[model samples]
Target chain A: MRAIVLASRPVGTPSRENFEMVEVDGEKEKLRAGQVRLRPRWFSVDPYMRGRMNDVPSYIPPFRVGEPITSEAIAEVIESTTEGLSTGDLVRAHLAWQEESVLDARFATKISSDPGMSPTYYLGAMGMPGLTAYVGLFTVGHLREGDVVFISGAAGAVGSIAGQIAKTQGNFVIGSAGSDTKIDELKQLGFDAVFNYKKSAPKDALRSLAPNGIDLYFDNVGGDHLEAAIGSLRNFGRVSLCGAISQYNSTGPTPGPRNFEGNVIRKRLEVRGFIVSDHQDERVAFERDMAGWISSGKVKVLETIYEGFSSLPDAFLGLFSGSNNGKMLVAL
Target chain B: MRAIVLASRPVGTPSRENFEMVEVDGEKEKLRAGQVRLRPRWFSVDPYMRGRMNDVPSYIPPFRVGEPITSEAIAEVIESTTEGLSTGDLVRAHLAWQEESVLDARFATKISSDPGMSPTYYLGAMGMPGLTAYVGLFTVGHLREGDVVFISGAAGAVGSIAGQIAKTQGNFVIGSAGSDTKIDELKQLGFDAVFNYKKSAPKDALRSLAPNGIDLYFDNVGGDHLEAAIGSLRNFGRVSLCGAISQYNSTGPTPGPRNFEGNVIRKRLEVRGFIVSDHQDERVAFERDMAGWISSGKVKVLETIYEGFSSLPDAFLGLFSGSNNGKMLVAL
Candidate 1:
């Protein structure tokens, strides 16, 4: 069995040298009565995974040094000792970034590979990134039809999916990307408007596009984007703070909006901060709607595929620099 | 009829010199069938009135220089041509700062004074200040029992009443006042703990008082108090931004909490800003509860009385300097 483990905590941005791809031979651990053994097929390299690598108090615990990092991944079951699961079944499991994983059968669920869909789709559209978008927009954001929504970091993994979900809800969706290519891609996905925030100031660009102002702001990249969104919000607006990728690496103070007090008072706004784990009860509801949307071609999944599990650090670091367009994934 | 008019806008804090007291004598000329002429008995000098004096955007229109300032007041009908209102009837009306006003009969709600209660009670606990605290705490803050509550400007009108309400609901209430006397007054009013924020740093004071953390923060002074509250919030904390008195005189950038992003994310906090007018539908509920609380002695009211109506400018300006003990009012 082989796994990529963290060598040490990085000071600023994580690098490839911080991880080591190690191989070890051991006795074949037998599966317990209700256990399953999986051969990893695909792994998710999400921005949230970066948080897990650092020693910070977040929604979840950080990964320890000299330990295998685990995330939602697509795998194939080689042996199973449960009533529902059987050997040779393709499944999704809470597995590590390793070639093989032994876990309880209940933690693994069968993955459907329909005629046109690839196995990689399970690790993305039907996976964590998709669920993150669903809960953040509908549950936390309380999104309604015809609402004007602005998605920050719209070219990234969760933002891309969140924008599409808002559009599907009959919302006027605007997205901000880092590059012209990503901006064009968002427009192709039926975003009412798209802007390259790297080229134009977010406040000015959003002001020009959304002359009427934003009703709901789904923030992925925080800091200036949060401030801009606050400035551009209409009266009685809703702000859903999902992530703050822009401020994650900074060591200095991130000056929040100067007129936050005035805006909040005059607009009578609601700014709620949330994480996906808070909405565990809605997971089943999310999966049901997401699966139907995928089947109906009403939803689309984009992947920035990075080859080999050893390159996980690069895929994770790429999130901050806008190196990936969609859910950055690593093929095992 | 005489009125106190805004002669000119003040440079920083307003003073009595900024108001011009003029007198005029006239008959009630062709008053409408459902109209009455009333003499103001008591007038409210609210902090929000300061915002109206400036030409800045607020929930309501700003007051124009050289115009008569208007506020909610209790008055006596001196002349009546209306079916409902009669001469010598005491009523509450939304009118101007003049000694006499001609208004529609429908705008005046007749009052029957209880032998035990004072007419001034209506202006403090049974009126706008009462409803402001009610709607802000329950509707916006989602206040719950056993929750630790921290209120800024705790000796002021709404803050004093709000602290008692939280205490009655079985919550441990902590309050911040300007002077040690006001802090002692808050403790005497049943605030579990109180601090003199003018002498003690809010963050350090709150930390020592509520080491476990605050569940609900009612923010009236927004600059450092809001910053301190944000830092001391517990997980799933709720912040209700009612007013920002600290920033009223601020001409420069408002310095606040530096790590706002981290505080919001780590706590899963909900920060909402509201004006009582937006929740007009809940007035019936507010009035009912407040009446019951006052009648049952479950809640108490306090007011700072300024003797003459001519002293209104000083009363309004006194709010910024923390000169009033409770709701500041001018009696005619």
Candidate 2:
């Protein structure tokens, strides 16, 4: 089995030299009770995986150098000796970036294939990214019918869904993307207004787009965009802090929005930082609502899938470069 | 009657030159329906007042040049044509910085003198600052019995009460003050641990004092203190951001805690910014509970009073210099 390993932690931006694929022996002499052997079908490459490369304290453990990095992936049950398991059962687990995995079945969740839909849905829209958007908008941002919400990184995995959900729930959504193409895509995704931050400053864009002031700000890229949101938020505003991907690969610390605290006190803003992993209580509701939206064509899924296993490294790096329009995934 | 007015806006830190004392005619042309004449005796000098000195859009309008800069004050009703108000009635209103005011009586709140405490208590401990501490601790910070709490600007009006309330509520409390004198004062106020930030770095001080992570951080000073709190906060910690006096008077923007977002995300921290004015529903409950605590000697009120009306500007400027500990107030 071939697995992607972190060759070395990058100082600034990660390059091809930072990651290497090596062959590993998947066959084991013995299998313990409740153990399963699986062959990964679709390998997921996500932005959060970049954090694991660095040896630092985070929500999850750092990815060991020379050891295979893993993420959420849906795999086929090549062999199973555990209860409620079958040979052809498809499951999702933190076992991606590798061609095969042999581990306890308790850690894996079986993916019930939606009729006439793709299994990659388990890796992107119907999975963690989808749940992240759901929890951020509802539980974190406190989505209201007439809320003027500005979502940064609007074309990314979480922002795309968050904007769509906010829109369908009767919110006036404004979004910021890195490219003109992504801006157009965000408009098609039902955002009321979309701006390309690379073309113009987000602060200026938001001032013009959200005339009345933003009531809820979904922050995915947190530097200047956060500053703009803070400036444009009305009294009693809420900021759902999801990620700051723009600073994820920096060699050193990046300062937060300078005007954040002053505006926070004046406007009485509630800025909450959260991880979707800590909010599994909303999974059932998220999946039900998201499935309904997808079925009704209210929420459309967009994926930039890399065709082969070798494209995983580029796919992961492309996230920082804004090369992918939506959810960046790697196909094996 | 003499009143203090903004002669000019200060560039960074305010000085006596920025303020002017002017005489006003106390005699009214006529007593309109619901009109009242007031003579203020005790007026507040809070950190929040500094934000008003600048010509910027904030929770309250900025102090205009040549206009009387006012805040919460306890006044004696000199004359009232309005019903339900007597000449000897003690009242609190948005009418400080002035020796006397003639305004509609509807905006004023009557202050009932407690059995033993002074009327100045209505301007500090049982008023806005007191309510700010109460709400910030329980409603905003979600104070738990065993929560390890850290409060910045521990010598100030709000922070002093916050530390004592948290300590008396059975939480381990650590505090940061600007002076050794303030640290000694905090010890008398019942804080478990107190450090002088001027003597050492707050981050290092907090690290030594709170070996166990901080569960709730009541941030009164924003820059370095906020950074230290973010670093020391445990998983799912809450930050009740009441003030950021460190950066309030800055002419230009100051960068926030360098690693704030990363720590907020990694630890799933909840940082909520609030103004006590938005929380009037808690006033009745706060007064009832605070009165009990004060009677039992569990909560102590501290004040650094400046005598005479001429000392108002000096008292206000002294807040920025850390010269006055406890709640800075003016007794006219």
Candidate 3:
């Protein structure tokens, strides 16, 4: 089986040399009790994976050098010794970046076959990214009806879904993306206002778009975007800190929003940092609401897909460059 | 009557040149309906008042160039035309920096005479500063019993009271101050750990003091102290953004904490900025508990009082230099 391993830690921006493809003996391992052998069908590559590449202590442990980089992936059960598992059953779990994985059955959730949904949806809109958007918007952001919500990295997976969900609550959603195409797509996704952040400063854009100031900020790209959001947020506004993609690739610590103290105090703002994994309690509601929205065509699923196992590194690196729209996925 | 008025706005730091002592005709204007003629007995010089001096839009309006600076003060109603207020009644209200103030009676709260307690206590321990500490702790920080609480500007009016209140809740409290005398005083006030921030870096101090990290940060001083608190906070930590005295005098926008993005997200920290006036609903509980705590000597009241109205500007300026031990007040 072919597997991608972490060759070395990257200094700043990651390159191809950081990862290497290696051949692993998959069938050589004996099937133990409560274990299942999985053949990966789809793989997920997210911005958060960059954090794991570093040798640091975090909520999730770092990816070990010379080992398969593990992430959430969809797989098919080829052989199972567990009572709940059977051959050819589809499952989802945090698995290694390998063609075949042998792991405890309990860690893998059996996916019920749905003809209306694509299996790859489990790696994108109907999966962790989707759950992240739902939890960040309603639970962490405390999004209310008629709120003026501004989302950074609006073309990305979580931001796209979050914007749509907030729109469903009758919010005036504003979005900022890196490209003109992304801006157009955000507008189509029911964003009341869309701006190319690469061209226009978020502060200037927000001034014209939301002159009355925003009620909530769904922050993905921190740094200046975070600063601008803080500046434009009205009194009692909320900020849901989901990711800081802009600072993720920086070699050193990024200077935070300069207006943070004065604006937050004067506006009585609430800034909450959250991770989706910390909110598994919201999964049932997320799955139910997301499925309904998807079926009803209220929430459109978008993905930037790459084919073959070799394209995994390219797919992951593209996230930093805004090369992908919505969820970036690799099909094996 | 004499009043201190703002002659001009200060560019960076305020000076005596910015103020002027002027004669005002107090008895020239007749008392109107529902009005009270107050003789201010005690005046407050708070850090928040510095913000009002600047010509910027904030939670409170800026002080007009030629107008007397208004703040929470204790006064005696020498004359009243209102039904609720009587002659010689002690009242607390936002009054001007003048010996005599004619204002709406409804704006003032009548204080019942307590021979054991000083009327000036209303300007510090039992007033806005005390209520601020209460709301910032329980209502905003959602403080739990046994939680590790870190307070910056720990020797200041709000910080001292907040530290004492948290101590009563059976929490391990850490305090950072600018002087050894203040540090020693905090230790006497039941703070588990106290550090002179001027002698040692807050980051290094917190590492040795709270090796396990703090659960709640009562931030009265922003800048390096805020950064240190963010770095030293445990997972799901909470920060009550009460003041930023460190950056209040900065001429330009001060660069915020460099470690803000990484630490806040990784720790899932909740940083909420609040003003006490917004939490007026908590006043009843605050008065009840604060009165009990003070009467029992569980909460000791500390004040750095300046004699006569002439010392008002000097007392206000002294706050920037950390000259005051606790609440800085001016007795007229």
- Taking all chains together, each candidate's TM-score versus the true structure is 0.96, 0.96, 0.98
Error of 2 at B323 (Å): 2.6
- Tell me the spans in candidate 3 whose CA falls farther than 4 Å from its real position: none
Best by TM-score: 3
Total clashes in model 3, counting residue pairs 3 or more apart in sequence or in different chains: 0
The DockQ value obtained for model 3 is 0.83
Docking class of 2: medium
lDDT of 1 at B306: 87
- Backbone clashes in model 2, listed as residue pairs: none
Candidate 1 regions with alpha-carbon error over 4 angstroms: B10-12, B15-18, B24-28
Error of 1 at B288 (Å): 1.8
Question: Alpha carbon lDDT of residue A291, candidate 2?
Answer: 88
Ranking by DockQ: 3, 2, 1
Provide candidate 3's TM-score on chain A. Answer: 0.98
Candidate 3 structure, TM-score to reference: 0.98
Over the stretch A193-259, how does candidate 3's per-residue lDDT look in tens digits? 9999989999999999999999999999999899999999999999999999998889987898995
Total residue pair clashes for candidate 1: 1
Q: Count of backbone clashes for each model?
A: 1, 0, 0
Clashes of 2: 0
**DockQ of each model vs. true complex:** 0.63, 0.76, 0.83
